[model samples]
Target: MPSLSEVISCLSDYDPNALPVAQAQQIIRDVVTPVEAVEKVALRSALDRVLAHDIISPINVPQHDNSAMDGFAVRGADVGPDKAATLRIIATIHAGGGFDGEVQAGECVRIMTGAPMPQGCDTVVPQEFTQAAGEGEVTIPAGAVKTGDNRRLQGEDLKAGKPALAAGKILRPADLGLLASLGIAEVPVRRRLRVAFFSTGDELRSIGEPLDPGCVYDSNRYTLYGMLSRLGCEIIDMGVVKDDPATLSQAFRIACESADAVITSGGVSVGEADYTKQMMAELGDVTFWKIGMRPGRPMAFGKISSNGRNACLFGLPGNPVAVMVTFYFFARDALLRMMGAEENRLPLMRVASESPIRKKPGRTEYQRGIVATGADGVQRVRITGSQGSGILRSMSEANCIVVLHHDQDTVHAGDMVDVILFEGLV
Candidate 1:
């Protein structure tokens, strides 16, 4: 693994004080290493887990050539383009059943959906498209269906000995069904990432505790829990640690010793008197930075070692909104990488701005927004009132985040702005 400084040295324009958001993201990606341990999990328990190995199909999907719908199976040669043809219904074949005898010319088997195609039959004529001519016979009109119509070819969905799901894929509901179809009862997936997180401050208190004269409830840990839980991480909520040196040092050491990554939500901004910053610097090769982004400007990222065990550290800002923004933009991707999951960055959707937005160049801005579609079917986004970093309610009330990129200026009404939908992230 490359040291944090070594990775930063490779960048041509590395700036500790005013790092661009994208540049900081790239640096964190380059420094962290993925976990190597793998475990066999039941197919039902594999959802959202990263696949440690490629899943190979043992048998062809559908197993054999079958009917695609409830229709009659007939030879295409019997139905001509010029006129209708009547054929004798030799047998009725339902799903999971096949004809015992060969289907001769002018003899069509009545095949239902998912039924295997009988011998000497290729096309299927829908019962509605055909009329009963006489006893045990049906007529197919011209141009109703041609050769191979409604017939599911063997191995069309998936072929045997082929890659069904590639390595590094985060399994979903559909993936589970696919694996079950291939007779995969167990899957090799990367072990769930262990993440230890806590909030650091002298003025913060847990919910059950009585509020002191200058103390407020600690909401960062709960928010972190929700976000980390969505990522499927094995979370270790270490509660709130005081700003004292001994307590902060012990928390850092214990977190590094217990988890693959450690996250703290305070004492990272400039000119802070708290010991959280000092303890982080003394314990590891952590770098504090003033990121060029709104709602989340100050952050620290590096590796910390405790009793020979090391874990990646992410020290975020103290404000509730800043903590959430920094986690989603920075720590979220890093933890996903450590879990051996593929990089699946959230897509930025461009929509019209409902009103003018004040912005300055050289710094990126993440403003809470409410997006709705107009009666004309045009999607437009409006800011959710005030966008203060300390105001957590803005995040709760908004459905999306309007992202004004670095080097971009103010946005005029009706201008197309990039947005990250909360539905995709939360």
Candidate 2:
């Protein structure tokens, strides 16, 4: 296991005070390791679980050569490019049936879709292209389908002993169908990650508690719960912890001892009277960072140990919107790694802006925005009214987060900006 200091020492431009977003992401990836535990799960229960090993196809898909269309199976030599040919229809083959008799020259068989091709037949002409001549003969028009046009070859979909799905893939609906097609009853997958999270502050209260003059209901835990649930983690919601030194220390120790990763929102900023920072430093090798980003800035990342058991730690900002931003951009990938899953970062889309955006050049900004299609079919994005970190309503109303890069200046109207959609993240 590599210490956080050892990892940071290797970086050439390591600055904790104003670390770049990209640099912080890379550091997190380098310091964390994937879990090695595995479990066998039934196919129905394997959805959204990461595969522990590559799935090899046991049998060839489409085991035999079959017809892809309902038509007449005939020899390629029977049809010509310039002239029409008439053939006698000898047999009619349905799906899942085959012809045992040889098809002679000037002879064709009526074949349905998914039916195995008859012996000595290499092409299929659709019923619409051929006209019926007499009682059992059909006329093939010139320039009809070419040879081998409507036939599905054996093992085309999947060959025996070939890899069907790679390891680290998160199983989805289509994956389940593919596994069923290969007759796989169960699969090996990584066990779910155990995550323990809580919010810390004396001014925070639960939902049922009465609102005092300076206290407010704690909303960060609920948001964190929803996000962690979507990731398929075994969550341990530790609720709200006060700012007392002994209470905070006990919470950190218990969280690290019980879960694979510990996440907390609040008590990470500089010059705070609370003992959150001191307790964190005493517990393990943790570093506080003020990243060059908007909505989320103060954060702490490291490994903490208790009773010889250790877990990764992430201390996020206390504001409602800031907590979500920091988690999505930082802790999400780290947790996925701990679960032995592949890198599944949300993709950024470029869309035109509906109006000019005020921005500085040194820091990155994540402004909530709604992406919609214009009357001309072009997609454009406009910021949701105010982007304050505490205004959780804006985050709920917007469909995407407009990402302005660190070196980018003010964005003019009609300029293209990168955005990560909520549909993908949630």
Candidate 3:
């Protein structure tokens, strides 16, 4: 792997201070490399796991031509376009059963959904489109179906010896079903990433500890735990490390030795106690950035080493909401890359704003929003009650985040604004 300096040298317009959000993301992408470890797991156990190798279909899906609907299978030539056609139902074919009997020109087969199509049949006219003419006869109305309609051709879903799933794909429920259809009992996937995180501050206390006069219980670690767990990472919670330089340095070393990444909330900003930045500089190549973004501005990102073992470090802001925002926008993608996941950015959908929003140019803003369908049936977004970085309730009440672009100014009521939903109706 190339050093962070070498990587940054390649980019002509690299600025640590006042870094653009896109530039910060691109820098992270260029620096991080995927972990190279593979394991074989059962199909059911591979959900959310990143695939290590391309999965080629061993056999065609639906080995034979099957019926897509519960209907009558007949020759397309027998069904005229302008006139109704009547045919005798010679046999019935149920799902998982084979119909070997041939259908003549004036004969049809009563086929259930997923049943193999008869030897000479090409199309299926759904049962609803046909009326029973007699005990063994049915009539298909004109313009009911056309040639090559409602027939699921053999290997239509996955052909034999073809790639079905590519490497780096994070398997979902549908992917598991696809594997089951191909009779894949096990799949090879990348090993889960191990992440170690802690909160640093003299005024921070852990749960169950008595609160001091000005100390507050640390919530960053718990939130980080939840976010990291949802991303399929094995988390090593280091608890709350004090603001002392010696103690913090030891924690960083231990974290680097045990995990692939280390995340710390607080102490990255230009405060009187610059021990975190000083210790980071002594240990590895890290950069402190004042990014051009709201809620999250002070951040530290780079690779750090301890006892010859190195791990990526993401030092986030001290504020609770700022930590969450920075993690979602910056650290999440880098961690996904390290875990060997090939995923695109979450899509931003445009929806009307329920009220005017106060925004300024030059810095991107991510406001917590409640998106819902109004009485008029149009989906609109309203900002949460308090948009403060310390107000954790804002994040809890929000179902989506309204993203205002860096170059965009204030937004008027009813204007289309881009939003990324947190809870989708899947």
Q: Name the best candidate (by TM-score).
A: 1
All models: lDDT? 0.92, 0.92, 0.91
Clashing residue pairs found in predicted model 2: none
lDDT of 2 by residue, 221-290 (tens): 9999999998999999999999889998899999999999999999888876246667777899888999
Show model 1 residue runs off by greater than 4 Å. Answer: 273-277
Q: What does each candidate score in C-alpha RMSD?
A: 1.1, 1.6, 1.8
What residue pairs clash in candidate 1, if any at all?
A: none
- What is the alpha-carbon lDDT of model 1 when measured against the actual structure? 0.92
Candidate 2: which stretches are off by over 4 Å? Answer: none
Q: State in Å the error of residue 424, model 1.
A: 4.2
- Looking at candidate 3, what is the lDDT of residue 152? 92
Q: What is the lDDT of residue 5 in candidate 2?
A: 90
lDDT value, candidate 3, whole model = 0.91
Enumerate residue pairs that collide in model 3.
none
Tens digit per residue, CA lDDT, model 1, 380-402: 99999988999999999999999
Better of 1 and 2 by TM-score: 1
**Residue range with the least summed lDDT across 10 consecutive positions in model 3:** 268-277
Task: List TM-score per model, in order.
Answer: 0.98, 0.96, 0.96
